[model samples]
Target chain A: MNNDILVTQEIGSFRKPQYLSSVFRKTSGPELSRLKEKATLETLELFNRAGLDNIGVAGEMYRWEMYEHVAASLEGIEFFGPVRSFDNRYYRKGSVVSEIKRKNSFHDDELTFIMNNAARKIKLPITGPYTMADWSFNEHYKDKRELALAFADILNEEIRHLYGIWSKSKSEVFEVQIDEPAATTHPSEMDLVVESVNRSIEGIHGCEFSIHVCYSTDYRMLFEKGSELKLHGYNLEFANRDTNELGTGSEHRKAFAELKDYWDIDNTKFIGIGVTDVHVDYIEPIQLIEDRIRYAIDAIQDPAMIRVNPDCGLRTRSRDVGYAKLKNMVDAVKQIRKEY
Target chain B: MVKIRSIEYGLYPRSEHVRLSISKWERNALDHKSLGKLMDAEKKEILKLFNKSGINFYTDPLINWQDILRMVASLSLDTPFEKISRYRETNTFYRQPLVESYPRLGEIREEESTPDSHLPGSMYVSDNSDHYMYFLPGIESFVSMSFLSPELNRERVMDSFLEIYLDLIKKHGMKRILLFEPYPDSHFYEGNWDIFGSAQVFYVRYGLTEGSFSERKDSGPFSLIASNEKEFDVAARHSEVPGIALMNSQNTYLENPEKLRKSATKMSSSLKLDEIFVTHTEYFDFLPHVIANKKVEILGKVGD
Candidate 1:
């Protein structure tokens, strides 16, 4: 495995282990909590074993399942049965039925757990505010803006709490990746999205801030208009569309081609290029990943301004598939390092 | 007189009957035609069950539009549509509203607003006679203007919908349009009051707006879907205006029907709501068994 890449991280979430899932269903309160922590440590150990540069303790924290995680934590939000969409089931719009109160802070205990157990720096993913508001049914707040801002305020408190924990531990936090998968859908609300994001990260310092959009998004709108947003990096899905573009002779690497648009954004310190497509089962060849990385670096016209990651989290994939994908990604990065 | 009408928010069902079909479709085992037929049947069943809930107004099942994304997608966005925009509702579920270069108001076809029916479809609901049909040309500004340039005014986004209503009013004598403005907190306006002012024009002197509530001086009574005590307090504070309370019956409120009943009971006692709208009729599917022997009756039937 290549250790040449500065950071090889799972976006967030790994598939819940089968034994743990069974134990969770069978066990009660404290026993279930104990199993969850065990599973989290095991999950992180698996990633570290996979030789990952960054690890996140995602067990039972709802890693990057933005709305569900927030709904599980916050007061006033109520979740119903799966609302059947085209093919998949989503938790019905979590209605804000009461005044939103903090039931518990997010990631503080999880980060503490990670710091004590893991050798690598932790990359904690907090679901961004826009996603929480956009996905839920706002029965409480007056508008989407208020709903999002309320989520932003809650998230800010959680982030601050997390930062305090991290500071006290004095452990390395690779970066805080704010997952805003909903940002690009409603372009008109980009202003609010930007404002809400700024609110979520307001005043917290020392930790790097990265925004991860798990789909092909309106980067031009987000980066161009959201220039005021405090950010250190932008992670987006490229391999989901450009998997076919991996062919050496392929003329148009359409996903990477859009990188030219974001080349001029001043506030964006780096682009965490998604080189693995998490949606599929096929293990992407190291050569293909190397090609994708090379194309992003070439297209963006900077080698230092690039990091490599999967198109999204691998929680959906089986553990075997997820591990294979990460191992391949790291190997590809190593090959690139050798070539360069 | 002010009337309280129940409005349904459409999130499709996954009953045991449709579960296999859904799974098959997800696995690509079932084609679009089969899945469409299965989903259409499921929606009909859902609506029928909803009708039995004894609410003031019945909203026909509207499950086909896969969230707002699929709802907006039926329209023909201008050519050279760039697919850069995406909204991921879940890990797997998402909608990418393609950027329409030349968005024309005329591009919105009639079938875009209609419920799922294979009968060479028309614009209006199949049976608007029984209940106040929730009609719309397209989703409001936040979504309709999503793909359009961000600089455009929210009013401009409402223009096409306004024209559709104008035509409906002229042709069908469409009296009351149920305005479904979902996002009132977007700072698109200051509060629910502000959203009501801009949107009231579309349904002015004629229809009902449920999602975002406000007091109307020129039109019908003020109405709102207050799910909790605070929202009820806000609606009650504005008690000077005659209005109806449309309580959200979905979510955790539905799990414990007793809680919902208690809230509704207390709310009605505190404020004289002209009418109470217990929303999301599908959740009430279990109501028959639950309320079978119970004397606590929070819902009553209404005949229009």
Candidate 2:
């Protein structure tokens, strides 16, 4: 019951658009090719150092999520996932649009297959319908709202198919993570995105659905309807902020208690708060991690549904930095549990 | 008079050169490539006359190389580039060790000795990485989706040229030195830099010594690093931050006949150098200064 959900990036280089371009080389030649190879191997090293065997190919070219695929490439360590190659942008031959349309195209499905094949717990993530619309330039739809809803439909289709894949893969994938990092930027789509998510999961399934909203400095508004228009849990960041300063969450801590006060905030609709920060490359001390954990526990007063994790996905950190933070996080939680 | 003038030398990514970009990037760029090349072709063209010109102690050209020559040299072997003194790592190449030795195709590799003494001090070359081979089947692309395979042995590949590059710098004549060291892109990759292929810095035995271009014999070509400036800076700052700066500016930029005649006027000025270096033209301009302050070396590029 005292378990907490956390959110962090692997390294921020993958998944995020702005960071990807930096990894490119000028000579677009063999030198560039060599650099790409270097980046991949380096990422694996980072993962191993963090004590995490799983790596999600965040969806460029390497199938880092599948154990067998990356086993040899990674020198025999398992922990990997696929990047759902769906897109709201240009429908070029090999673009996101085509990848998403493929059968069992969602990351959830791929991750499920991986989990089943490797006999491991799976982490299924997707760019929420609304977030995808907000970050991408939509051409197929008529208006902004329409485009978001249309994306919602596409996502709904993927969710249904993902359930099917889980069954076929023989893996019980209950964690359905809808990554809505753009939740703050387009709060307008909040309703549409939430609705589409609800609609998608309506009849198709019985899985623990979670929404990952991050990279935003503010989430005060999303706190109001913590219970309404919801799925399973909301994995939000309370650490990796705009600035590198630690021990703070955004500019105002005023809304800190808002989510805790929400009605029906329980084990079903969990609130995954970041206990450690991944930005600035500074790991959280055990005391700080404990404080964050305590804050969530006291505010919510419901340990059963509290999910504590790093400020966000540590996709951006080197292996040492990320793992140390997570290890501290897990340790702090255990400390809290002992006291409880 | 065979006067010996002082030369100042500081490695790139050093503390002194750290803030240089913040200040120097604003200076108006001269059309040195065109007019100077024309001047080299035996034409007369005076340029950038109004601004006060001190000898260039550093050049910020890219290390855009195909191989790991410069990274292996300055960071691993302690060998400086020939003519120009900047670092880069993409689309770069190396000339033969000496006038007779054949040039290497990719990165420089060290064979059986210390490096600084072996390589040439200067040479004119171009970025020559082949893209087709990079795009070959089985190569990785994309972050989460694009997959690639490591094509070559980073160590052996670098050493192949190290042997010859060091020998060349030690023996042959050099005009401008070129280095191919890459700055981390994920941190600052807008406009000025256009790199993305290898995003993370190579690290090794000790810890996170990534991001910096350091020369260490114990590690060979291995770097102790992560993938950003802060980490890299820490590593570089810790790597004995080479002192004893020396700049030997003899025939760097002022070798032309007319430029030589023109520089003769400034010769009467004082060249009080605790440490100073210049191209050949700078030597002419500061003749009197060199006589007064006394530290002038009419050495060829890189003293090779």
Candidate 2 regions off by >4 Å?
A: A1-109, A116-120, A169-173, A242-268, B1-304
TM-scores, all candidates, are 0.61, 0.41
- The lDDT of each candidate is 0.57, 0.37
Can you give the DockQ of every candidate in the order shown?
0.10, 0.01
| Backbone clash count for every predicted candidate, in the order shown | 7, 134
Query: Which model scores highest in lDDT?
Result: 1
Which residue pairs show backbone clashes in model 1? A143-B184, A143-B185, A144-B185, A144-B186, A145-B185, A145-B186, B176-B207
Report the lDDT tens digits of candidate 2 across residue range B108-210.
3322212222222111221221100011000010010111124534333333344444444334232223221222212111221112122111221112344
lDDT by residue (A260-337, candidate 2, tens digit) is 544333344777776556544667677766666665666677776666655555644555666677667666766777
TM-score of 2: 0.41
Residue range with the least summed lDDT across 10 consecutive positions in model 1 chain B: B287-296
Question: C-alpha displacement of B48 in model 1, angstroms?
Answer: 3.0
Interface RMSD of each: 8.4, 25.4
Badly placed stretches (over 4 Å) of model 1 are A1-6, A22-28, A58-64, A84-86, A171-174, A248-250, B1-11, B15-44, B50-303
Candidate 1 chain A: worst-modelled 10 consecutive residues by lDDT: A83-92
Candidate 1, residues A10-64: lDDT per residue as tens digits?
A: 7876787766655643776777667667778778767777777777554333232
